[model samples]
Structures are given as C-alpha cells and as structure tokens.
Target: MLVVSLIAFVMFRFIGDPVDQMVGLETTLEERAKLREQLGLNEPLPIQFWHFVSKAAQGNLGISYQFKQPVAKLIGERLPATLELSFVSALIALLAGIPMGVYTALRRESILSKLFLTISLIGISLPTFLIGILLIFIFAVILQWLPSFGRGQVVDLGWWSTGFLTVSGLKALILPSITLGLFQMTLIMRLVRSEMLEVLRTDYIKFARARGLKNRVVNFGHALKNTLVPVITITGLQLGSIIAFAIITETVFQWPGMGLLFLQAVQDVDIPIMSAYLLMIAFLFVAINLIVDMLYVVVDPRIRIGGGEA
Candidate 1:
C-alpha cells in the first residue's frame, strides 16, 4: 500500500505541474514564476515531498486550486457517495456470485451448468464499459425501465429518495451493479465451483456420504466451510478492484460518486483533489484487506493457530 501511494504521489507531482496548467500559455513569465512560488511549486523536490507529507499527517491535505477548499474536507464530503456505491455494488456481486457458484458446482456436469459456464466465460471476457452500455441500451433505451445516467438525490443516509432497500433504488441499481458485478461474479463463480469440487472429493466428504449424511449437510455445511478460506481471500482482493471499477462505472452512469470526481479532476488537472482522492482510495483498499485478513482467522482456525496443532 505504501509503495502504491509513493508511486501515485511521485507520478502526480513530477509528471506535470498544476501551477503551469492553471497559469496557461498566455500568462507572462513573471506570473508563472510568482504562481509557482505561491503554490510551493518552486521548492526543492525533497522539501515539497516533506511539505505534502507533513501537511497530510496534520489532516490538511492542501487546498484544491479549482475548488478553493481544503482537500480533506472536499474528500470527506464526497466519500459517502463513493462508499455507498461501493457497498451496494459489492453486495450485489456477492449475492449473485456465491449462489451462482454454489449451484454451478453442484451441477457441474449438467447442460444447465455448461450454459452457466459459457455465460460466465463471456461475462468475464467482456469489459465493464461495454457491459454498462449494453445494460443501458436494454433497460434504459428499449425497456424504458430506468434512467440510463445520473444519480438521484441522496437523502436520509440513502442513495435514492425512494429508500436504500426499496424497489426503486434497487431497480435503478440493478443495471450498474450487475454491469459492475458481471466480471467479478464470473471469476468468483469459477473459483467457488472448483474449490467446492475439490472439497467434495475429500475423504471426509466420502465418509459423510457413507454415513448417510444428507446431501445438503455434506455439500453446504461441510464442503462449503472448507472452501471459504480461498473465497474470502479472493472476495477481499476483488473488493479493492471493485472500488476502482465502480469509479469508472459511476462515470459511465453519470453518478455523483468519487469516481466521477476523480475523472473530472484528472481531465481538469486538479492535482490537489486527485492526490487526496488517490490517498483515500489507497486507505480504503488497505483497510478492506485488513478486515478480510481478520475475517480469515475467524472463518478458519488453522490460519490463526499453528497448523501443526490442528
């Protein structure tokens, strides 16, 4: 995470100058120099880096040249929307992926299973942007079921005025969420099916069968439990990627989330806002992985204690 942060920081600072960009080519030489000094752009690289880190540690994060507001405050205001989208997207992905994976695994040799596999493969092959567009075409253009772009008013700690879990919000969400979730679900489905298959072939599962254990208990209780470690790990990693993807999807959907802000900031070369946004995303990714690690220990005792003891 620190390495990624360093890379993002170095790229943003050294790759270009916000001062020069804001100054424009028409500005006089003296104006450019003055603006550079004003924004601390004239400082030595080491000093500038220190200044950024020190101010960041103190919760400053500098001020945006475009917005004329503290970067931290600006990010804080936008953070909720991003979080809302991310959580909703993840929920949709997991809900769809896990069950699909389980069913595919249980019926791996069936024609239906093969159809699912084909669909999953195609889904995994397609890009999110393409999927987003396709979804918009069907649901937005043809069906006239929901709005194709833009978010509704966020009120009452919810994304839609109808409600967070209401039919309207969920209906609006289906397209974007499924578009975002498609690739991830495809990947997770394959993983879960393969893992469950391996677990089902284990000697304990055979023994349980010999003992006349119910198929549900053998499959869901026994095989599923053993397969959870890898599922949990992959799910955590995918969550980080999903947040990044949601940024793109949000822009495609014209949603007022952190992703749209990041896209605009990049286009306008708003370095301060971009930098702060990148840092926040970095923190979210690290925090999510940490939570997943903790969950791993709780879900599987072998990871917590010495494997030899087990």
Candidate 2:
C-alpha cells in the first residue's frame, strides 16, 4: 500500500496543479499561494508524502480537489457498484467456465466440444471494450432487449445502495458483466481443461478406472477434484483482476463505479482521489491474495500436509 501510494502520489502530483483545477482564472497570486499552502502543495515532496501516509493510516484519506468531498466518502459511495459488477462477473465466469471446461475435457473428440473451444478462443481474443460495444449493438440497438448504459435504477439502503433488488438494475448488469467476464471465463476454461486432461492421465485416475469406478465418479469425484487446486489459484487472481481492470468496462458502460471515478480523477488531476484509489486497490489485492492462500488449505489437502511437515 505504501509503495502504491507513493507511486500514485509522485505520478499524479506533477500532472497538473490542483489549485488550477480548484480555483478559477480570476484568482490572484496571493490566493493561489494561500490555496497551495492550505493544500500543502507548497511543501517538500517527502513532507507531503509523510503527511499523506500518516493521515491514511488514521483512516483519513483527505478531501478530493475536484469533487471537494472527502476521499473516503466518494469511494464509499462508488465501491458498491464496482464490487457488485466484479462479483457478478466473477460468478458468471466461474459458473460457465468450469462446466464448459469439464465437458470439453471429457468430450474432446465431440463436435460440440470443438464448438465450445472455438467460442472460448473468440472470447479470449476479443478486447473488453469491443465486446461491450458488440453486446450493446446486438442487444440494445438492434434487438432493443437491454439498455445500453447506466445503472438503470438503484435503491439506497441507509449508507449503501444496490441494484439487485430492482428488475431494471438486474437487466442493466448483463452486458457489462458478460464483457468483463468473457476473457476470464475463457482463461479459466482453458486452464481447467488442460489440468483435467493432465489429471486424467495420472496413475491415481487410472487406478480408479481400473477399480471399476463409474465414469462420473472417477471423472468428477477424483479427476475434477485434483484439477481444482490450480483452478482455485487462477480464479482468485482473476477475481482481483476483475475489480482492478473494471475501469475499461465501466468507462464503456458509464457504470458509475470506482473505475469511472478514477478516470474522472485522472482527467481532472484529482490527486486525492487517485491516491486513495491506488491505496484501496493495493489493499484489495493483498486481502484477496491472503484469502486465496487460506482457500488453498480448504481446497487441497496436499498443501495442508506440506505446511504441517515444514
């Protein structure tokens, strides 16, 4: 988080003067100087960074230069949208990818399996923005089946708001979720198929088959179980990537998520927002990785045994 914060600070600090964005052209030199002093932009880089770090540690992310609101407040307002989109995308990827992978692995010679592979290849090859645009063209423009952009309708519940309870909100999520998830789904599918094939060739799988185990039991209970260790790792990392990289999809869809907020900050040179976003994303990556590490023990007994021995 410190490294990310420093990088964000250095990178954004020099992009433009925050005072220039904060103040109008008619502002005098004395006013600009006072504003700089108030914002601490006149301080040395090290001192500024120290103040940033210290305040961040105390749960104060500072106020946004552009929005003139608290950084934490801005993020808190937008976080739910991003998390909702990311989790829905991740769920779509895992739900579709894993079954497709298993089927392709088990029915490699079938024409249907070949078709799925072809579709997976297309999913992997398409860029996210292009995919989103295509979906919009098909579903929104041509078919008039779904809305092209916006969150549609959001229901506020105290401090948090959500779209899931509303029908239009659920409809609004479909395109962006699919666009964001397609690449990840293809990746997970390919990984699972490859791992399943490898696992099937192992001695344990052959032993289970030789023991007259049913095909479903041997394939799913044994082969699929063993393939999941790598799958879990990739899925966990991809979930983090979904959140971090949702910027493109959010921009394309105008989804009002943190990514969209970050883009606005970049354009406006809102250093506080940019810095807070960097630190938040870094913290999320760390937290997701820690959870993934814990999940390894739950998914794979070998990891637990190795840890016990060491």
Candidate 3:
C-alpha cells in the first residue's frame, strides 16, 4: 500500500503543479514561483514527497488546491456518501447475482439457464456509464418514477432514518447502483455457477445423491456450502470494485459522491484532492484483499488444515 501510494502521488506531481493551476495563467513566473514555494512544491521532488508522506502519516493529507480546506476534512465529509453508494450497490449486486447464479447452475441446460447466461454475458459486456444512462432513461425519463440527478434535501432526519432512502435520494441512487452492479453481477454469477457445478461433481455430493437425498438437500446443503467459499472470495474483491465503479457511476448519475469529487478534481487539476483520492482508493484495494484472504481461512476449513489427511 505504501508503494502504491507513493506511485500515485508521484504520478500526480508529474501530471502538473496544482499551485500553477490554482494561481491561473495571468500570474507571472515569479508569482508562480512564490506560490510553489509557499506550497513546498519548489523543493526537491523527493523532499517534497517525504514531507507529504510525513504529514500523511500524521493523518493530514494537506490542503486542497481547489477548496483551500484540509484534504482530510474534505474527504471526511464526502466519504460517507461514497461509502453509502458503494455499499448499497454491492448489496444490490449480491442480492441479484447469488440467486440468479444458483438457479442457473441448478438448471444448467434449460432455456431459462441459457437466458441467464446470455444476460450475464451482455451485462459483462456493457460499460458502466452506458448502463447508467440506459437506466436513467428508463426509470428517470420514461417512467418518471425517480429523479434523474442530485441527492435530496432530507438532511434533517437522523442518520439511521429513511432520509437517504427518501424519494429523491433513492431515485438518485437507482442508476448508479444498477450500473455498477450489472458487471459485478455477471462476474459473481459466472463464479457461482462454475463453483457449484464443480462442487456437485464431488464425492460427497455424489454420495448424497446416491443415498436418495432430495435434490434440494443435495444441491443446497452439500453443493452450495462448498460453493460458498469461492462466492465469498469474489464478493470481497467485488466490494472494492464496486467502490471504484461508484466513482464513475456516481459521476454519470450526477450523485454527490467521491467519484464526482474526483472527476471535478481531475478536470480542474486539483492535485491535493486527486492525490488524496488516489491514495484512499489504493488503501481500500489493499484492505479489501487482506479481508478476502482472512475470510478464506474462515470459510474453508480444508485450507486451514494445510491439506492434511483427515
């Protein structure tokens, strides 16, 4: 994670100086130099990097070039909305994908199974932004059932209340969540189907079937339990992907989340915010991978046994 963060920070600096961008073209070179000095950008690259790293270690991401606020404070304010969107989207993906996958694998050769496979393929094929647009057109325009953009003004309600799920907020989420979820749904469905099929061919599953156990019992009880290990692994990976995609999906939906903030930062050359966002994303990826690794031990006892004979 440290290496990744360093690379992202170096890349952002190489891209351009936020000091100059913030100061504008009308400023003289001397004035720009002063601004650079003020921001510590005029120091040697390695020294500047070290300074930023030290500050970051102290939980200070420095000041935002755009907002002139501390990056940490800005991130703190926006983090909740972004996390909310990503979490809700992941929930939508799991709810839709897991059942569809189990059903498809159970009926492998049927027409409904073939249809699901086709849908999964298409879902994986489409870009997230395109999916967001299609959803917005359908739900927000044609049906007029939901709002097309922006979070609602129901902020007075308590955090645990349904304020975020109010008419406007839910409408704003509809496009982004579905858009981000479709691709993840495809991946999970395929993983679940393959794992379930493999589990069904195992000795225990075969024995259960031969022992005259009901199809539901053999499939759901024996096969599904084994299949769950891989499902859990993929779900963990997708949680991070969901967060990354939420950036794009949120932008497409014009929802006020980290993705939208990152987009604005990139366009306006807000280096501090952009670098902070990049580092935050790298951290999330590393953290999620660690969690997935730990989950494997919990979900599959065979892994923890080191392949020992029972």
TM-score per candidate, in order? 0.89, 0.96, 0.90
Clashes of 3: 0
Which rank order by TM-score, best down to worst?
2, 3, 1
RMSD of 3: 2.6
* lDDT by residue for model 3 (227-302), tens: 9887987898889878877887888878777888888888878878888888888888889999888888987887
The sequence of per-residue lDDT tens digits that candidate 1 reaches over residues 1-310 is 5565566567668757677677667999898888778888777877877787777767788887778788887776666666666677778767877788888899878887888899999898888898999999998999999878765544454422322555555566667777778888888888888999899899999999999999999998898999889999998999888887788788788866678888888887888888877777787789889999999889888778957776
Better of 2 and 3 by lDDT: 2
Candidate that would win on TM-score? 2
- To one decimal, what is the Cα RMSD in angstroms of model 2 from the true structure? 1.5
Model 2 residue 34 lDDT? 94
Q: Write the per-residue lDDT of candidate 2 for residues 1-310, one digit (tens) a residue.
A: 6788888778657877778888999999999999889888888899988998899888789999878899999999999999999999999999999999999999999998899899999999989999999999999999999999988899999878898999999999999999999999999999999999999999999999999999999999999999999999899899989999999999999999999999999888888898899999998888899999999999888777987766
Error of 3 at 254 (Å): 0.2
The stretch of ten residues in a row with the least summed lDDT in candidate 2 is 8-17
Report the Cα lDDT for residue 40, model 2.
Answer: 85
Off by over 4 Å in 2: 307-310
